[model samples]
Target: MSENWRLDPDRALPADAEIRKQARAIYDEIASLPLVSMHGHVDVDLFAANKPFRNPADLLIVPDHYLVRMLVSQGYTPAELGVPFTDNGGTVAGAEASDVETDSRVIWRRFCENWRLFRGTPTRYWLEHEFAEVFGLSAPPSAENADDLYDELTAALARPEFRPLALLDSMNVEILATTDSALAELDSHAELARTLGPDRIVPTFRPDSLLHVRHQSWAKEIAQLAEVSGIATDDYAGYIRALEQRRRAFVAAGARATDHGHVSADTTPLARTEAERIYTAALRGEATAAEADAFSAHMLFEMARMSTDDGLVMQLHPGVLRNHNARIHEKYGADKGFDIPTRVEFTRSLQPMLEEFGLSHDFRCIVFTTDETVYSRELAPLAGAYPSLRLGAPWWFLDSPEQMRRFRESAIETAGFYNTSGFVDDTRAFASIPARHDLARRIDAGYLGKLVAEGRLGPDEACETAIDLTYNLPRHAYARHERNA
Candidate 1:
């Protein structure tokens, strides 16, 4: 094994020599193309401030749920990994809160000591790429060299060239989008537009809180939405109007799409009278769990209706049971990596919305799922038939190399290439953006190469498909937002 932490030139490519050669050729064609990050959780304030990263631990470990969650699973507590606790009045127990690690070097040492835990994981690939390519680290992280690597990263972060916006430019990211709450004023995004051009950073409207009426925060979010839009949300019609107003505001502020993270793909709209009754019951805190589900389904359909009217692309990814661990959620809040996938059915769930707008030329919807089985069984056929529907790239847990290859294999037979939306990093870690996209491009190249080697596709056609997957698809999918920008 190599002693140094170095990335192989043909990493993640096919193992067969002939296929690898062809894949390398395809990868070279699109290696330096500008990135189109159309969906992610990176805070827009990172660009608005243009501040240097504080330290190695903060930059690499603290904010990333993927890293933190994996470490916690390996018997390391969040406090040990330098994750901040929620500001509650002594709610969590001793083991969860006692003697939290405060020094960045201490937290970094813990990470280096546990480096072997991530050996075959995609997290390791991304971290190693950031270490060697971004920070010029030649040696692999270990307990003995943890301090040295920390000093090196700290010094690198202190440089003005390593600031967030500078790193975005260095990474060749042309268009980046941040997920924003429905009630968000997008003041930071507005400032970013003036400073960095409107196309550089766009906001994606996410209304998950408003849709899940059973959630404890639904009423509060509705109040905030009413406050922001200056419209009454006491009735169903007024609430819909308020949401429409906010969507228009997002559009004016350079938003290209609206994202839904519902637990199911259900879009069955309820009758108007029934929906209004549910709305009133939800306001009175009298809704049953079933009623909440019904209301949420109807709201999703309503969102599709609004998208058709306003020309905003709709992006829906369902079947995630968010905050699966109640203890972790109470102590650390959401996105601490406790979300797990559930099986999802799309054909029947999405029928009502698709029947209404699937044939509309002006409307577009991209469907994503953690349930890989549905890719071939349901999502592929749906996207292939519906003009508005497009298959989103393998997302979240399925973002690995093997899963991505499986996605292409399964979806292409039915949906073909054009019916699929291109890659979106869907990341909160700023530095991992390029690494994730690079991995996707390499995997696509290998898939295309295999097809060419098997006499399934001509070399010319495979190369064109590679370019479309890397650059053209995302650009065209998001062209409407860019035009409005």
Candidate 2:
């Protein structure tokens, strides 16, 4: 065998010989399906500009919190990895004083030389796929190959075919949904749509900044929302109206879904007077943390109500303890990969919203969490009973091969396959999109293969399930058909 690192054709398939063969067959049938990435954080400006990637480090390492977090755990700092200074030249609290590495080559070298540290991680898997399949690398990165590989990647990125827009086609993405602020003008989305056609590069309305009332950016975001929507937000009613107007703007911009990320899944509704009181207090900078949380939960209910009226598929990803490391957060800004997962109780937390709109035909919500404990206990049962609820794919910390299989095993028996939203690669890394999707599909195929081999499912039925999991289910869950209309 050659010494060069190469991906096995059946890399993620079943390990048992007979089961492996069946899995390979299943994977083969669905491997080339066009990707439907319904929820992602890729910057829309990439497609709008169609610019050559800045460098290998910027494209692969700097933007990916997954990559950043692991390297940080091993004692490397974000600044050392070429992460830019966002807060006053990295002079914030707990900021490391080491010179921020500005050379992309040095940052890339640090990453490539330390490749062994990524073993048994999904980051490693995605990087391997990106290097081998996407970039056509013949060997895995190591200290010896660091400089050569950096030069190779730099050259490859300079090619016209390697630009972001062209790479989207190369990845065979049928449609992409970008997570955007509720207050955004979506100028980049408008420009990309003009060239790529509508619904191909669509916006996903994300209004997290508006609901976290006590955040430093809240008052500013509200003002920006007022300016963008042309609706004054001097009062609670005006604030609601401005948010509604923003949602409408997103729908007009070809959004089929709206994404909500909260620390808890609480959807408890408050009395209008109570909500008004909270909003007024928040505006006056007098609201307590508990009050802010109550308002956030209440607005989730409000958002669901709005979704019912406008038909934007609602996506809730809850239970993240954002900014666990206050020091890194202060210096690096948000999404520098210090977020931690917490145990989430969805049954009581979601009861109020479910009681109101769970059976409605017009409302559809796909709930996601990194909390695996709720998959079988709370989320699956809730989704099984509520027509409007669907279990989102295992995401963030739980989207690995083992965890994906665990998710299928845990949720499918109760909620069944149809009640689940198909895989959505919730990522900011542009190159990892296809790699993540492929891993999910392969894991699914392996799961289906086991069922067929056990005689629980026929081969034809398994194939159909594979195809649905790969393409069809995502379209239905994300309201893709309605995207253009």
Number of the predicted model whose lDDT against the real structure is largest: 2
Pairs that clash in candidate 1: none
Q: Each candidate: what lDDT?
A: 0.90, 0.91
**For every model shown, what is its TM-score relative to the native structure?**
0.97, 0.97
lDDT digits (tens) for residues 277-344 of candidate 1 = 99999999999999999999999999999988888899999999999998778777788888999999
Residue 396 of model 2 has an lDDT of 97
Q: Give me candidate 1's TM-score against the actual structure.
A: 0.97
Flag regions of model 2 displaced more than 4 Å: 1-5, 88-90, 93-98, 480-484
Each candidate structure's count of clashing pairs: 0, 0
lDDT of 2 by residue, 26-121 (tens): 998999999999999999988898889999999999999999899999999899998876765546565544567889999998998889999999
